[model samples]
Every structure is written in C-alpha cells, then in structure tokens.
Target: MLQMLSSLLHHGSSVPENSPLPYTVKVSSRAKNARLKMTPHGGLVVVLPEGFNKKHLPALLQRHEAWIKQAAARIEVHRPEPLPLTENGLPYTIALHNSNEKWSVVYNNQGRRVLDVDDAGGRRLLLSADVADAELCRSQLLTWLKRQAHKHLIPSLGKLAAAQDFKYAEALVRLQHSRWGSCTSRQLITLNTKLLFLPDHLVRYIMIHELCHTVQMNHSKAFWALVSKHDPLWHTHNVEMKSAWKYVPAWVSAQS
Candidate 1:
C-alpha cells in the first residue's frame, strides 16, 4: 500500500548540538521499514514503522550521517531565496496559475474582519480587516484559498480521472506543508492547497501521480510503467517538482 505517516512527533526536536542536523520522527502503521526523508522546507523526517524499537534510531542516524550531510548540502545549494512580502505582511496579489486566475487584494479597514471577491468575475478580492491585524487577514485569505482550490483543483482532478478511466473514491484539499499530494489505500486523494501556485501542467502531473497510486500502491517498476503510459512526461514533471516550492508565496508559509 502507499504508506503515509499519520502522526508526527518531535516536531522541532533535534539531535545534540554537534549532531548532523535537526530531525523529527513520524510513526506510520503501514510502514514496513524505517526510512529517512529530507525536504527543503521540512528539513529531515525519520519515519518509523509501528512496533519498531526507538533504541535503534541512533544507529540508523549514525549509518546515514554521511548521506544526510550530502543531501542537506545539496538542498542548501538549491534553496530559493524567500519571496518578498508586502509592507502589511500580506500578498498584494493572489495568483492561481492552475486556474489561470489572478486576484488583486484590496485591503479596506471598515472595522470588520471579512473577505469577499469583487463583482469583476472574482478577479478582485476585498479584504475588510484592521490592516494591523495581519494574522486575521492571513487566516481569512487562507480560507478563501481553500475555497478556490475546491472550486478549481478538485473539479479538474475529477475530470482528469474520468478522462483516464481512473477510479477513485474521493478527493480533498488542505494546506499541507511538505507534500504536494497523497493518496490513501482507500483511494482517497488529498492535494495541497499550495498547488494553486503551480503551473497547470505540474498540477495535472501530481493528480495523475496520485491516481496511478490508486492502482499500484507502491512505486515499483510496474507503477512507473503505468504512470508513463498515462503521463508520458512523468519523469520531467517529477524533476520539476523538486524545485516547485518556489512558486508558492511567502504568505502561505507564514500562515503555516
């Protein structure tokens, strides 16, 4: 099955000061082995299968220390510079590339905390909040982003699945931190709201990737063969995904 860690522990926990790097542990019921995952933004995550002995973690880290340092350095070299933020700590414009929509955000201090799209076919957003209460504005904007993802991303995924004759139970959208998308063993697909920032082709690639997982739960040769059949450019898209985080706005990470 496509095992995914359901619980995260030691969120900001790190090894000793002299250790290689900071890391967190994740417990996965479906995991059959312990593995390490490194992401540019999430840093390092040590995933352990259920019933695994915690005492062995030290040994695992020691063995992987060389690989860890190399991977960390690679990420550091390719990490994109942070996006500049507006003076009010909010994005002046919201762009949903997947939907070919760009929204201009207008902040109005009408003494109320609310966000609404203008009548220009939803191209403009009117955010009414105390300009100083950036936190509230961000929360409201995030809620709106979820709605947009539901309106755009979910339907697009459904259409793609139908076109490819892929069977899936349901699809969901959330503000995920490290993952672009995931598919459960039960055939449910969860997409990150940050996808709204990606190009349309990449978004479709992620959808197809998850849909293929519904048929083949593991990334074996057969699974990749299936993906290749559906998305001929899966390899190119996969490489592009490694650096796609740059498309997302700084405010999105700030809210997280």
Candidate 2:
C-alpha cells in the first residue's frame, strides 16, 4: 500500500495558511505541462510536471491570479456543506441510483485496520475500523462509490445507447469532481462516478445527454433538440443536477 502524507507548500515565505487565494501543488509523473484547475472542495490545485522547480509557482500564480479568484468565488457560491455524522459517528446510509442493491456500513474498532464493505444485493456492509478514523472511512466510501458506479452506470449506458439507436465507440466511468460527464469526437463517453448519488431521472438524463453527443458533437441547437426528444424534462433535470452535490457525503466531496 502507498503511505499517504500531508504537507503544505507556499509560493512565498510570507504567505500564511489563511491567505485568501491559498492553493495546493500536486506533482504528477503523467503531467507534461503545468495546469491549474479549481475544484469543488480542494480549492485551487496546481498540477506540476515531475522535476519542475517549485519556485516558479509564484510567477505562475501571478499570471492567473485574476482567473483563479473569479473561479474560486463561483465555486464557493454552490459548494455544499459537508454532511454531519450521527451520534455514533457513522454515515446514515449508502444509497445507489439505478440499482436495487442495498448496503450498510459497520465500523469495527477491534478488528483489522481496514474498511470492509459487503455489496450483497440489499445487504449490509461492515467497515472494520475505528469511528475516529474518518479519513479511512471516507477512503473506503469513495472506493465503494466507484464500484457501485461501474456495476450500475456502465451497463445502463449500453442499454440507453441501444434504446436510443445512438452508437458510441466506448464509455468510461471515473471519479471526476469538475464535470458530471463528457464525450469526445471519437464517440467515447466518460461519466463521473458521483452520478450514482443523483436521482434516477437525472442519471438517465445525463446518459441521454452524452449519448446525444454521439450524433451532435457540440451543444448547438440541434444537439439540445436531440436531448429534448429523448429526455423531455432535460431542463428540469439540468437544474436539479446543480444541487446533486448535497447528496454526496462531505468526506468524499472534500477530496475534490
């Protein structure tokens, strides 16, 4: 297992943790260029390619300071407050969309140091760990969420495509925090795993939305007309999706 350590990296020695425009730097081997993105909970993230000097972050921040501030302000307005745990310090329930399977979380304080989950079609899951270790619980929940998405969302996409006579080259399910889903010109549809937390209607609408991209690559008038033909209530679904983050537990959403 990989050991996770948390630390801070400030562009300037005088900058404090309370700086209004504070940010985090993530070093990735796959990154060939520096990129900045505003996340729902992680705030501003500066992805730097490996072997890059950290000192240049100050200059880069200066260049995009205005954009960063505007984006941060926009995200803050829609950010949902983290869900509070019950008196027992456990999540109330773990629900899945478009699936009849049921699951429950049980934290084991004296057992092995790992979160164990049981996805027994409508069965309870036991998290064999202490309640105080919220991070471990969050990690386990995120893992379970991804599994649920694959089990439910992937197959549903195929069915939806066939029903609508929409052909796609491929589909991918991921834990993206920025957007719910996307499609490429190659007809590859990528969906966010968090969609499992949304309502059934919204989930179907999103699937239809992406499948429509297989025909209309852009969000032009024809693209929306296609989406409307499939999901007549696409407008309401789109508006409802804005508040879907409230369904996600703070622990998972905070990792964005």
Candidate 3:
C-alpha cells in the first residue's frame, strides 16, 4: 500500500507545530517535476514533474518528522469527514444534483476511468468506478463531464446568441470550478457545465449574458442594457448563481 503522509502547512498556517501534515513523507523519483500539495485536509500529494527525484523526498520528510506529526494532529482537529476525496485521486463534485433531473452515479471498470451517460434508458445517471485507484476514477469522471460540455454547450450558445442579435464566432463549454460564463475578445465564449444544475431561468440568463459579450468585452452600461434587454430578471439569477455554488459537492475539479 502507498504510505500516506501529513501536510506541513495545514490550516494555511506557516508555523511548523500547528501545521497538519504527517511525518515521513512518501516520495518517488518522478516527484521532482511534481509538487507537494496539501488537500483541504492534511493529505500530502507529491505531483511529479519531468525529471522528478523520488529518492530525495523521503529523506527530506524524515528530517522534518516533528513538524509533520504536529501537522497531522491539526488535520484531525479541523478536517471534515469523507476527507474531501482529493487525496484519493478523486475530488468531490457538486454536479448534476438537480431535483428535477433524473440522474444517477456509479463506478465502472473500463480501460480508463470515465463518467458517462448510459443512454440505454438506464435509470442511474452515475456510473461505477472501474479502476483501482480513487484518483484515476475521478480523472475519468471529469473527462466524461468535459465531453458533455463540448457536446451540449455549442448549440445552446448559438441559440442564445441569435436571440440577442449577436453573431456567434465560436463557442466552447468547459467544466470550471468558479464561473458560469466567460467571453473573450476573439469572440470565443465558454460556459461552465455546472450551469446545467441551475434553475432553468438562470441558465437562460447566463446564456444571454455571454452572448452580450460577443459585442462588448467589458461590463459597461451598454453591456447592462444588453443584459437587461435579454434578461430583466437577471439580477435575481445572478444572486442565485452565487448561492448555488455552495451546494456543489467538494473536490469535483482539478485542484489549483
């Protein structure tokens, strides 16, 4: 079994004893290219970059044993249960949790990890993990979501653009942790797949807002006018979007 180590900087504190990491870090040579990142808890992750030094990290961990112990203790006090899944190579997600939608989740063992819709009239929207490592399973699930965004958002963005009299150049939908929509000067508009979980009206407003960016890059007065033209009730939807983020499950996306 891979040995788990605690973090050195738990709770965002710089002090060594108060930290939440553990003693004796586990390292691999490939870890040189990667970084030692801490999860929301004290879980240690050694992200390996190219030319990693696997042999050196464990010795370093030994040198800092006392600090690691202190950090682990801190993690026990402040970390929440279910352990925020990021350490297991899977993060929590607040996705597709709509009461109106009929969806289910499961794990499946394919050559690679993936979350896919079994359009076979399958009642469950979620799939089972077909892989051994929890992290691999989550990577596959995220890849599935990315595919869904590309398939669904293109047409949706087009329709919304037309409704607002904006000519669309191109559209790309992605699974982003913090945004509903973003517009670029190149006429490239991106929508977050998470938008699907919002109330229908909010979804409509988000569409309209991004289409408006086709004409204006800034949130200027004319921009507001355009947004208001498409969505007079947009203010309400905007507030809902912010509040809705809280309900999303944890560790659903790539860690920053």
Candidate 4:
C-alpha cells in the first residue's frame, strides 16, 4: 500500500490498484505544517514540514484523495487560454505584447539549426529554416525571448535598484515555470523571463518584492512592510500575479 501511494504521488494513478490520484511531495525546511496546493502549472504539491516523518505521507495522501480529485477537475475547467494564432497560422511569428517586438518564424529543409535568425534590420527579422516542428519553433522563439529579457530586464532592474536605493550583487533572467522571481542571500536576483508578458506595474512589483528580500529574507511582517514601502499596491499586484500566467500564450506555456 505504501508503495502504491508513492507511485500515486509521483506518477498519478491510472489503474484501479493505483486509483486516478496524482501528487508531488515537497519537503521544506521552513514549512511548519503539512500542506497541499493545486496550481495550474504545478498540478498538485504536498508540502511536508521539516522533521516530518516520511511514513505519514501515504496516509496523508489517502485522506486527501477525494479533495485532490475535485481540485484537479476544477483546474481542468479553468486552464489558461491559448493565444490566438494569425490568419496564416503554421510557423507563425512570435510577438511580445508588452515589449512591442515581433519575430517572423520560418522552417525549411536546409538550415543549420531548428531556428536561424536573420536580423539585418532591428524592426524586421526572420527565423530561417527547419521551424516546421512545433516544438523546435517554440524552443527557438523562447530563446529569442530570453535574449530580450537579458537585454531589457537586466538594465531595467539596475534602474529600479538605483532608484530605490537598494543594491544587489547581480541579476539573472530565466524561464521559471513555478515562480515569478527570487532573491538569494548572496543578493543575486533572478527574474522570470515570462514577465515580459505581464503589465509593467506587476513586473515592477515582483522586482520590488525581491529587492525587499535583500534586507528581510523571510516573508515576515517586516519583510511585507518593507515591500509595501517600495511598492504600495503590492497586495493587489500579488493577487493579480496568480492569474498572470493566463497572459502567457499557450504555445509558450506548453513548452514549459
């Protein structure tokens, strides 16, 4: 039974012996109590507090199987909507709605890579050859998006840091599926490249949230106070951030 439960947690159940139950276990050093969460991106995560016995996991999963199924079903009903494609859809161009930049994608038999970019002029660029495979096209376009984040996000973070009188050792832009951004004890900050899809204010809130962590690492009252001082509408922004994934086009999230 324990082995069956472990399989259910990792692989989700498909057969009667296992049941149609699925979950992921996360052991956190800071968690004080066992918890469960269901998000559109990371279907379900069972957070185990520090020092909690692993032996209790199977029973815990069994107890919550019904709730898990209901929650998963609810998620299926409200999945993020995919971005609409152009009239000529296949091998379509990728557009950054917030950044105001667009790249034309193409596929062919002879090309060095899945995507070969030709950018003679800044305004008009072409992704030449072998992009016919949907996955390859998505990968290449995501790469382009990362480049844009480095080009734009890094400088923007510097400006925000300076304006707020907050200092950080460095900044990194990455494609994070589960988080918007994070700041480490070393003062290194990582911003999600996906922020390019969100509105400016929401993006700024995430920056401010991480910068605040430089002084208060934990999400204690002091940390929140500091965050509010920097970004006044942080609460609203935080709530909005939960649903912001909807803004990301389906072609992109599918790759995630």
TM-score of each: 0.69, 0.63, 0.57, 0.65
Per-residue lDDT of candidate 4, residues 115-221 (tens digit): 54577655433555454455555576778779888888889889999999999999999887657889889999998888887778978888899899889898999
Runs of candidate 2 exceeding 4 Å displacement: 1-90, 119-122
Residues 81-124 of candidate 3 have per-residue lDDT tens digits of 33234334454433453224444455455544335566587544
Regarding lDDT, does 2 or 3 come out ahead? 2
Greater-TM-score candidate between 2 and 4: 4
lDDT of each: 0.81, 0.71, 0.56, 0.70
- Which regions of candidate 1 fall more than 4 Å away from where they truly are? 1-84
Off by over 4 Å in 3: 1-101, 108-117, 123-132, 251-256
Full ranking by lDDT: 1, 2, 4, 3
Whole-model lDDT, candidate 4?
0.70
Reference-based lDDT, residue 30, model 1: 89
Poorest stretch of ten by lDDT in candidate 3? 1-10
Per-residue lDDT over 150-224 for candidate 2, one digit per residue giving the tens place of the 0 to 100 score: 888989999989988989999888887557788899988988887777678978988998889888888899989
- Residue 23 C-alpha lDDT in model 4: 56
* Lowest lDDT block of 10, candidate 4: 1-10
Candidate 1 per-residue lDDT, tens place, 128-173, comes to 9887887888999999999999989899999999999999999999
